[model samples]
Target: MTLLAGRRVLLVEDESLVAMLAEDMLLDLGCEVVVAMRLDKALAQARTGSFDLAVLDVNLGDTRSYPVADLLFERGTPFLFATGYGRQGLEEAYKAVPVLQKPYQAAPLKHLLTRLLMGEPPTREGTGGGPMPCGCHISREQQPFQVDHCS
Candidate 1:
C-alpha cells in the first residue's frame, strides 16, 4: 500500500536493539529486510544480494561501514546512512548520500525510502531541506526512542 511495499532493503547496524527496531519499521512498511550487524556480513550482502535500497549505520563497532557503502556505490544502489552524526559523519566523498539521523522514526524512514524508490537524488541539505549541525539529539532523559532529524 506504500511505495516501499515489497521492496528489498539492506539494513546495516551494529547495535542489536537498534537493528531490531529498524527492522520492525521496515517490516511495517512492507519491505523485505536483510540486516547485517557486522561490517563483513554487510559487505557480503552488498556483494551478493539485490536490493532496492539500503540503510547503513556509520559506525559498526570497531569499524566504519564505508566499504559497504563503496560496494553499494559501485553497484549503483540507492542507499542512506543511519547515524547519530548527521552529514558531518560521512566522508567527503559520500556527503551527498542521504542520511537517516538516529534514532530512526517511521515517518522519515518512510519518506527517505520513498524518495529513493522514486529515483530522487538525495542532497546534502538536511532531511527537512534545512541545515542542521549534528544529527543526534535525544531528549534530556536520553530515551533511545526519540527521533532526531534525518539529514
Candidate 2:
C-alpha cells in the first residue's frame, strides 16, 4: 500500500467494468490511477509525464498493448500486464514482465503490485504474466486463471 501511495499509474483496459474495478482497487491501494480505455488516450497521457508505473491489458479494443509496453520500456517505467488471456496468450518478448491475472483478491494483488513497484523479480508463474524466478505468489491448487469478463 505504502509502495504505491504517491506513485503515478496509468491503467489501460478496454472493458468498462474491469477498468472501473481496477481503478477502484488502485484507489484502495492509495495509488494515483488514471483510466485509459484505449491505446491512443493512454499514449497521449504517457507523453505528458514520467509515470511511476503502469497496469495494462494485453489486448485493448482491437489493439494490442505491446506497443505501449515498448514506449513504457523506453521511458524506464516498469509495468505489469493484466490480461484475461492467461500465460500462453502472452507474446514472447513480454513473457518476462510481470503479469497479474484477473479475479485477484485485493490483498494478493496489492502484495504483488507492491513487490513489482519495489523492483523485485518474480518467483512463481503468475496466474497471468510473470516469469517464475524471484519468489512470487502462485496458486498451487489451481491451474492458471482466465478472465473473460470482457467477452
TM-score of each: 0.80, 0.77
lDDT agreement with native, every candidate: 0.80, 0.70
Looking at model 2, the pairs that clash are 122-134, 123-133, 123-134, 123-135
Scored by lDDT, model 1 comes in at 0.80
lDDT of 2 by residue, 18-105 (tens): 8888889888888888888988988887777668878888889788988778787667687778876666677777777777777544
Model 1: residue 78 alpha-carbon error in angstroms = 0.5
- Decoy 1 TM-score against native: 0.80
Clashes of each: 1, 4
TM-score for candidate 2: 0.77
- Residue 3, model 2: lDDT of 73
Instruction: Please provide, for model 1 over 57-111, each residue's C-alpha lDDT reduced to its tens digit, 9 standing for 90 to 100.
Output: 9999889999998898778788888999887787776776777889889977886
List ranges where model 1 is wrong by over 4 Å: 120-151
